[model samples]
Target: MQNLARAVLVLFGLLVLAVACIAVSIEGSEPSVPLTEEDVIGTWQGDRGARLEVTADGRARLSDASGWRCFKDGQAGVFTGEGSWIMAQHSDEGPGILVKFTVDGAPATQCSDHFAIHRADTRDGGDVWARWLGTGSKEPYRRTPTG
Candidate 1:
């Protein structure tokens, strides 16, 4: 009876050790790296009828446009308006970019998965544009980001 109990204990210990080793091995495995500009260079289509293609050369073509725009080293667009531009991120709100161009006169901000456009003149009573790229029923073109 003693020998049988000892054998069972040893088997249980071995099983526990094996499980621990497997867990450690899984944890130590390399994690996946996020896609860089190269991976995202090609055109990407969203669930809605929107498409965006980012060029490795710093040009971005949005929504099947006829041509692309040069972003000038990630700082091409200018934000302009009145009240402080704000970017709503998480629960905390952040500063928004003031775009000055006539085409993109609306103030804007880039967040994790979306960009917002706000009118600076109104200050507190401006409209808030949400980034949705028209994926669902509502036709919104607020470009969201993906990791």
Candidate 2:
């Protein structure tokens, strides 16, 4: 009975350590600098055929030629949405933005609602990168060239 109890305690300790490691990995690093509307305003295209158009007036439009994996509410195929956005500092993730919008003219889904964009590159025709709020994976976006 004592051996069984010791094994259970060891398992619990391993579980706790695993959770702590996950938490640390998910936390975002400090931003090099604050992000502004002007910095984000423009047409950004993702590698996955996703496009984001942020306007100076706090308006945003999102379109995905191929349905986004993040939207798992049976929302697939060409999707378009319009919504408002704002830049804010996350307690654990440094700087980020919260975008509230509906998909397919339906009520907004919970997924892909927030993004933590890092200001790592200079704002002049440089690549801007962002990631989902709770995940460490990043997606790179480039500004569409204008005439």
Candidate 3:
């Protein structure tokens, strides 16, 4: 009985440690250098037709830049709009970008979305931005060559 208990404890400890390591890798640390508005000014593309542009003038442009199953009002359509954005740094949130844009101007009828952008570590090239989708998930956007 004692041996079995010890083995179970050891396995649980190992499992916890593995999970912690994975969590750390997934929630990466702040960039080596703090992010700046100028640094993020460019075009970022992601899966689907999503594309985001951070202009030097503190504006953001979007093209098909919403979650999957894009909808307008009660209908369906891709999203495109322009809005203001800024580099935001909070003690708890670390460094991130807050983009507040609306899709009313687009041909689409009605829908809304917001973005909380953060830096994510990648295997190659520059760091990507993780656009949080509520508290459940995130979408990673990488800078494109043509943007």
Candidate 1's residue-wise lDDT over 8-113, tens digit each? 9999999999999999987764233322333334444544455544444544434432211222244323221122122222223222222111123323532112
Please report the candidate that would top lDDT against the real structure: 2
lDDT of 3 at 82: 66
TM-score of predicted model 2?
0.58
Per-candidate RMSD vs. true structure? 16.5, 8.7, 6.4
Per-residue CA lDDT of model 2 for 1-147, tens digit only, reads: 999999999999999999999888756433355677766678878777778888888887877635444355554456567778888767776676777666665664534456666654554544557654542124455667655
lDDT of 3 by residue, 1-147 (tens): 999999999999999999999999766664565666655678878666678888888888777644433344434445566677777754455665666565645554332234445655433455556463432124566667653
What TM-scores do the predictions have?
0.30, 0.58, 0.55
Instruction: Tell me the lDDT of candidate 3.
Output: 0.61
1 or 3, greater by lDDT: 3
Query: What is the lDDT of every predicted structure here?
Result: 0.36, 0.65, 0.61
What C-alpha lDDT does candidate 1 achieve relative to the native structure?
0.36
Q: On lDDT, who's better, 1 or 2?
A: 2
Q: Which lDDT value does model 2 have at 71?
A: 57
